[model samples]
Target: MNLRKVGSKTNVLMMLFCILFLTSACGSTVSNNATAETAVATSSSEEKTETVKKTEPVKVVWWHSMSGGLGEAVDKLVADFNSSQENVQVEAVFQGTYDESLNKLKAAMDSDSSPALMQVYEIGSRFMIDTDAVTPVQTFIDQEKYDISSLEANILGYYTFDNQLYSMPFNTSNPILYYNKDAFKAAGLDPENPPKTYEELAVAAKALTSEGQTGASFAIYGWFIEQLLANQGVEFINNGNGRTTPATSSLLNSEASVATLTWWKQMLDDKSMMNLGRKTDDTKKAFAAGQIAMTLDSTASLRGIVSSADGKFEVGTGFLPKPEGSSDGGVVVGGASLWIMNNKSQEEQQGAWEFIKFLAEPATQAYWHVNTGYFPITQKAYDEQIVKDNLTAYPQFQTAIDQLHQTKLNLATQGAVMGVFPEARQLTETAIEEVLNDSKSPQEALDDAAKAISSKIEEYNLTVK
Candidate 1:
């Protein structure tokens, strides 16, 4: 009886030992599983963190000079782009006129207040490059092997320096002869055959003049003078219109320029053209009101002018007039380009390029063309259905595209560049006034203006270097 009891106790002890061992092993397995789960959770958390960091949108501040209706169009474009993607969010700030916007940019150069991107007038290109504050668009172009073959070459030429594209043309236009078709018809002139030369333009202007209306009202705008000179295949600055080398002197007093001012002054003296002062806005109003029959203005003004004259008269567009017998010249691209500022962060700069690409897209350019009168800067934009429809609705706008295409690709047509272009323009405007007001002969006015600009060019060249 004692032996049986001892054997039962030993068996019971063995079973208890086995139970403890199994319990310890199970506890260890559960502990290991929990630890593995914690590791997995930590890894997943990091993956999500990395994804968030990678996908963060870059905020780019874009400063622009667009105002009034044009400003609204700019806002709509930015809004549409912002809604279409998550990679970039653009904030477009209206900085005022081209000169004013450029002034602000100059002031903000060394501060955090500088914009990641900016819209600079075509004339600001030299100054922009001289400032060393730009990342040439050619950089991104080469990095991505991006296809820019679809862009307008003449438009691109204005922004290119040293065979490199410095900026992206956003809104581009050329000066055109905007006239009242109804006025032409009333004056016994063919509305379809608008003036194509300075001599012809003068005759048409006088013919269009009537009891209540003057034939034309050209604003004393220096841009128009620059355009007229370029139209005659004349260079505005030496060094190949500042394309071959940095411009060292102003060619503002070329024979073509003197002749151009003389012709314009003759029109004023003959009472065939009105001196509506320097503001294009005033000239536009007078034209819209039927007080003036013809005007020289940017194609960018087409939409507004057409709308303004909606019920009054039909608007007609013609190529910018050249000198009589002149056969080898074209209009330089007017309007502005979008430039990526060098002071911005790489991420922000990339975002700026993305936005620029979006703007240059066929669809976007078409939208811009219809909403604004500026050229789309892309030939593909003409293929867009909206562009087709808009062209059908307002056939007059076709003249601008035609004019742009017909322009011979020369340095003269590509336009001039200089660091002191804005000042030079002011000087040129003053020269035009001097001629128009009988204060100075066209030759004398231009000679003085030229001398002053050459000095400016020299001073600018020295400072930039």
Candidate 2:
């Protein structure tokens, strides 16, 4: 307290010391605060940069088996998707035929190097779904906010497993009979009238064939065999699920199956039809060359026939004839659907989903159907003005559209579900080859095939369990 009474100089010196002390303390506090704030700003900036980097475009690899120009079309689809999307780039990789694609997919899955999406055959759907490696597309669409109501019923139901859609139906086709119009007329049959029942077809097939032209060559594959048996109301197995369910007995050895085989055998024996062995392309060539008057093959064959015909022959199309007095059962869908792989990142899954939605769009479906002769998978596409406008321009395609209208909801016909269906098909084809070559009677051939199929079913069932 006595320090206040000090001399003026002394007082000035004391004041200076106090001022310096206070100034130093305040400057130190301010310096510390400045450093803390600068650090916070730097940390926040880094976080924002990291967030942007993580949110950027994701790559989705798609493996497929579509070949030739169809393969090019798939690549174009991916390119277009990449161009349109900023957050996703789809890579479309060709994996070969259906069997090859499945093998590659299996290998990829086992190695955990699976693609984001893969094209899989219909017969393989049950096997793939059962493995739990695929996320159902319906679930993906729902989780990812896609509109599934726009999808066509026939297609939507094809990929549905236990009420969940496992795959997106793509490149769909059905079996149809294609005949040469000129050949029909030359045989003294009405070119406009195609056989509407199997009985009529058998008679017409006989009349259509001559020494120069053969009638009704169908592929020896199970697709046609399955269709024929389904048309006759025969169940290939005890359960409606073809190769998927574990049924011990081969019900395909039933009377209807025997009848169908015998009919084919009769045609072969009578020389009314040509059994060109197990090759589909061979039959296609014979029909295209006008050497065969009629052929049953995929509806997709329309484009090839139209283009390759080169104005040489008139091509006529019609629905597959049912057994007489039998309701027209649904023809099993042929072609592949898209499966989402489990190895993709969350961001990539979103992108994969986006591309799938793009492919499922009604306009996209219409374009695909028109260009490739595959049926449009949505009612919206079929009802669109564009489809209506082109109806006159493409009359042959209308036959397939009409055929869909005749489809019944029989599970036997909706399709066969089995684990080893591809193998079963090959076995059936072998039997057909034997029957055609006189190695065995039709009954003996089918019975032998049934035994082989029965053994496969037992094996597949064990795996399913």
Candidate 3:
């Protein structure tokens, strides 16, 4: 068998074993054997003089939504932490996908069985803040007096709510363009040169797409809108603050936003861009299968694409293109962050904080990025000589960092804080489908979306306030 095929099969088997272990262990109950201990103690006092260790370990429960190799990487982190720490024990549970994890977390909150920490996505970040379900991570760090200057400002903005930090930004990711060099060459385009402007990309896409290939696609529809709006200097909501202000309302129907939507609609109309359906999982799989030549997805998708292609594809990564005659704009960060859940004992809270800090350590951050393709959230992590040396070998890893050079803290691009963002995203995606199918013009579709989403947002905001 091919070496890469063997590696793929091995990865699958390892994942299967891990799932089996977790499923069996979660259902099993182990009782303390006081009777057996009593029998053992019945021996001679001299023989029993060997001193037994008798302290219960402090347990910290962490609920997260990482799967496949990323999940394995997290498990490794937990094992390393457990092996090194004598007083605290950490249990990292795979709580399904992002939406599933969020629902499970809310259910846990209601049942008084919530984990000490839970992974939360950007779309739901605001809801997490509104409910007061999460304890502020910055407060914890300040109380413990941990050094945080090394954490980058750009990353801090993503989780900041009302000027106060509420969550530790873990697994942070941003959008980047990934293309296949072989496809570019076949299309008679420069393999090393990617589109710098959206118009240029559209032209290149027309040439690049064929019967079995697509020019470009995106993993997250909301992320694409986020970037497009930023590129066009448009805001999705109105508030000086990011993701924390309940007074903010939707801006999906703005002129710039309408233009962005129009561009996507035109692409679909021309058949130069393919909508391989939504969902990051399906899109990434299609790209790895060589069915698509270019895709814009989370930087974290790098690890999965690399693994799936098994080095068979020549991947070329670049910063997202700016629209013609417009300033290049920022892209909102797309990954989940670790949030501290409420109602835990002080000791457990502190222990959970320690784990969060452990994740922030420069060395640990480097390990995670190298293993999972997530961008480093702290300058200290990337500044490490070791991390820098590793990047020299994998230059594409820096595409996101380069993209950040153009980023600014614009409220529209920083992120939105509406209570029903997930639902809004679904609504926006529906509009995208209508545009792709030519059911309506982009403006018409988005206008309908804006009204629908605004109603829901208002309903949610009212309850939260």
Candidate 4:
């Protein structure tokens, strides 16, 4: 019994030593294995995180003013761009109408949060430049050695200054004469030969007006006034329409502009033309409802007009009529252009440039032109098969293409590039309204408008300087 007890105690002591020594070594091995596994897991996780980061897209914001059908086309183009590449993505934000968009953009500029890309109306070119917050499109074109030889000269001229392209012309349009074929036939006028001059238009309007229908209608917008001046080779503002230097004053009270207003007022007085009072949509509606026989509107309206007149009557388009006895000058380009913001990063700027380049492609231009009725800014777009098919399907669009091709690349046709052009346009609209209301004569109203615009121009120039 004593021997067994001693053996048991010795065995217990031996077991305790073995337990202590093995516990330390085993615990250390287990700790090392756990650390190695965690290291591998972290390394794998980091690799996955980097892979996800690499696959993420660079988002570029595009603030635009397009809405309705035009807006849909813009969305399609953006989607196409996003789907075509894995590196960059474009997000289009509708910023209301052009004027509203410009106002918002001004506010955004102050906060240094302007979009990477923006679509500014042609009249905003000078103002955009005055801000000095835009990266001239020429910079990228030159840097990339991009070939813009296919671009329309007239469209390019509108956005060019100091021998450099400040923006890329995107959705370009020109005002044109839209007439109802049935109305023309009923009035005993040749629908094939639409009005080519204001005099002819007046004659046609006299015949076309009867009963509850007016012969023609147009909004009291200054754009038509500008087109009239440009068609007569009249400068809208001094300093070569602000292309050579900053414009100090406007030529709103020029004889040509005065004559144009007088003619328009007379048409209103004769009851042959409907004065839609600044509401462009009223004119469009009136024309579509067959309340008016002819209307002056942008080529961009072709799609809407045609769709509205689908079964009502046939639609005919022609160049915007010139004043009687005026020589063949040309119509100014009327549309917006794409501008890249200067405050963005280099990668953002490069991404914007890529988008601009993509839009400038002939196929894209053709698609835009066919879908939105905007004039193609590139000649190659006209050569595209889709564009040719569209021209064949709707011969009405051919008129716009022909008219754009006929436009002379001159300062008058290039249009005014004044910093206060938007305000100047408003003044013109107000002057027209005053004349229509018989509150002032055309010359008197235009004189007052010219003075007001001149004052604003002076004030704006001083502030910018």
Quick one: best TM-score, which candidate?
1
Off by over 4 Å in 3: 1-53, 241-244, 307-313, 383-386
Regions more than 4 Å wrong, model 2: 1-55, 242-249, 383-390
lDDT of 2 by residue, 86-202 (tens): 788888888888898889877778675678888898888878877888777777767757667767677666677667788888888888888888888988989899887777878
lDDT of 3 by residue, 1-465 (tens): 122322577775754565467565532321123344455566655364544334667899999999988899999999988898777899999989999999987777866678988888877888888878778988887786888888877778878776778898998888888888888899999989988777888888888889888777765376688666765556776554234346445678888877777777677668877787778888888888888887888788775666676667788888777778875457777788988877888788888888888888888898888888887777888877778876786677777788765687667556766668888888888887788777878789889988988788778877876
- Per-residue lDDT of 1-465 in model 1, one digit per residue for the tens? 122323587765654565467677765654665687778889999999999878868999999998888899999999999999988999999998999999999999989999999999999999999999999999999999999999999899888888899999998989899999999999999999999999999999999888999999899999998888888888999999989989888888888888888899898888989998999999999999999999989888888889999999899999999988875889999889999999989999999999999999999999999988889988999999999999998898899889999999889999999999999999999999989999999889999999999999999989987
Query: TM-score for each prediction?
Result: 0.89, 0.85, 0.83, 0.88
Q: How well does candidate 3 match the true structure in TM-score terms?
A: 0.83
Give the Å error, residue 250, model 1: 1.7
For candidate 4, lDDT tens digit of each residue in 115-188? 99999999898889989999999999899799999888888998989899999999888998999999999999
Winner by lDDT between candidate 2 and candidate 1: 1
Candidate 1 vs candidate 4, TM-score winner: 1
- Candidate ranking under TM-score, highest first, comes to 1, 4, 2, 3
RMSD of each: 6.9, 8.0, 17.7, 8.6
